[model samples]
Target: MKQTPERILLPVSPVFIAVSLFVAFLLNLQPWGHWVGVPDFVALVLVFWGIHQPRRVGIGIAFCMGLLMDVNDATLLGENALAYTLLSYFAITLHRRVLWFPLKKQVWYILFLLLSSQLVQMLVQFIISQRTSSWFYLLDSCIGALLWPVVTAILLAPQRRSVNTDLDSSL
Candidate 1:
């Protein structure tokens, strides 16, 4: 028989969530080039928080973050906001169910979510620009999904519960 060590989760604070989002936003600022199809860390963070802390991080936060992303990218304003809001709605809607799955499986679902948001974004850009876009833009969704495990491990690290195994005798 195999023994799996049991662990508990510690309560998380809102500040931690805020700081992580801010850091993700900063990471999003890095210029990954228009051709690399680099993942959007901000989107990844928003989805993670949307799934894990919906009450604290809702569509409003996602919208605000998306707006910031819009300003940062210098693209059509509200493009990212719309897409991110849609993503937030989907993530929040399925958050409870998604929570039940293990991290590996969650990646597949998150990938779908990421792809949907990217599709929305691509549509918006297509409508505004009215030009055929290179398929590389969709690469961000795949990249984001690929990086989901790393993001999960980093975010959940702080919440891991440890059993000291030594009982305290203090009354």
Candidate 2:
């Protein structure tokens, strides 16, 4: 029997996830002061994938990616996980509308999503540290949101062709 499209894509490409995570690791490693770290590449990539392919990129993967980010950044253990999981959940839930939006509009939506994750992180940090974070904490969202098109185009180009074929067979 032929495998359904869903079956073929269900496991997803672990290699892709690994590549994304590795890129995120490198971005996080860039030497920077407390003010201007690289944008959270992992979160953006995960959001892109989650919204574009919810069946493949779900909460577990987001949680794992977040944990990896936490290890790389040495933030509180669950901080990134909490943020990523929540973000992915939201993305997947809204995938229908999000997938249909134009790239620029998608960037705006992603900005909101990214900000929500950061706000959660801030709240958790505040509860622990009893202080507010710097304005720069919000800067990464702007950079990430702005770079959404470049990032999505580069990452999804190959998948785009395949996605059409998959969609035809699945629907």
Best by the TM-score measure: 1
Candidate 2, clashing residue pairs?
none
> Considering summed lDDT, which 10 consecutive residues are worst modelled in model 1?
162-171
Query: Candidate 1's residue-wise lDDT over 37-144, tens digit each?
Result: 788888899999999888889999999999999999998999999989999999999999998877778988899999999888888887988865677878888988
Error of 2 at 1 (Å): 45
Please give the lDDT score at residue 162 for candidate 2.
47
The residue-by-residue lDDT of candidate 2 on 57-126, one tens digit each, is 8999899888887887788899989999999999898888986667778888898998999899999899
Clashing pairs in 1: none
Query: TM-scores across all candidates?
Result: 0.90, 0.80
RMSD of each: 2.5, 7.6
Q: How many backbone clashes does candidate 2 have?
A: 0
